[model samples]
Target: MPESVGMILTLIMNIALFSTANYLAVKLSTRNVKRRIIAGVVFLLFTPVIFFSTLYLGFTWDDTGWGAGIMTVIYTGLYLLNGLILLLSAIHIYFKK
Candidate 1:
């Protein structure tokens, strides 16, 4: 299998893990606002990481410079989104709580 395929498989696995974890966490929680917010944060954090990592793997394996450049742009956007989610989650968990 190609690097892109492997990365996609990893991404799919992450999605499955995250979904199951989130479902169980929510089921176990007391349904408070804080718990909901934290769950949202976890979802947000995992999504962008999978996206950026997949793009990186694809970019690294691709032979065409243009494909690599496009993937680079996508990866950068995903990275920034992940950072933003982290910052927002920190603020929400600290100041908002």
Candidate 2:
């Protein structure tokens, strides 16, 4: 199978895992805002970790220059986009008027 196929399958599998984990974590925790927030925060952290790990695996198997450039652009764009969104969210949450 192609690296892209592997990447797609990995991405799909991780999404399922994260979703189920989040559901179970929140469901099994004692009813409290802290537990839910902790689960959400952990889910947030896992997403990018899983994404980059699968991306790294794909990178290792891919060889084309065009694929490299496209992946670089995608990876950088996603990092910047996610960082900017998180920054904005944090500012809004912690600095609300």
Best by TM-score: 2
TM-scores, all candidates, are: 0.41, 0.47
Off by over 4 Å in 2: 61-97
Worst-scoring 10-residue span by lDDT in model 1:
78-87
Q: Which of the numbered candidates is closest to the native, going by highest lDDT?
A: 1
- Model 2 local distance difference test score: 0.54
What lDDT tens digits, residue by residue, belong to model 2 across residues 3-56? 688666655654565457645864654344445455545555655665566456
Q: lDDT (0-100) at residue 62 of candidate 2?
A: 70
Error of 1 at 36 (Å): 0.9
For model 1, how does the per-residue alpha-carbon lDDT over 1-97 read when each residue is reduced to its tens digit?
Answer: 7857755664565456545764664564433555655655665666666566655655566656455456546554544464455445555556654
Task: Tell me the deviation in Å of residue 55 in model 2.
Answer: 1.6
TM-score computed on alpha carbons, candidate 2: 0.47
Residue 8 C-alpha lDDT in model 2:
65
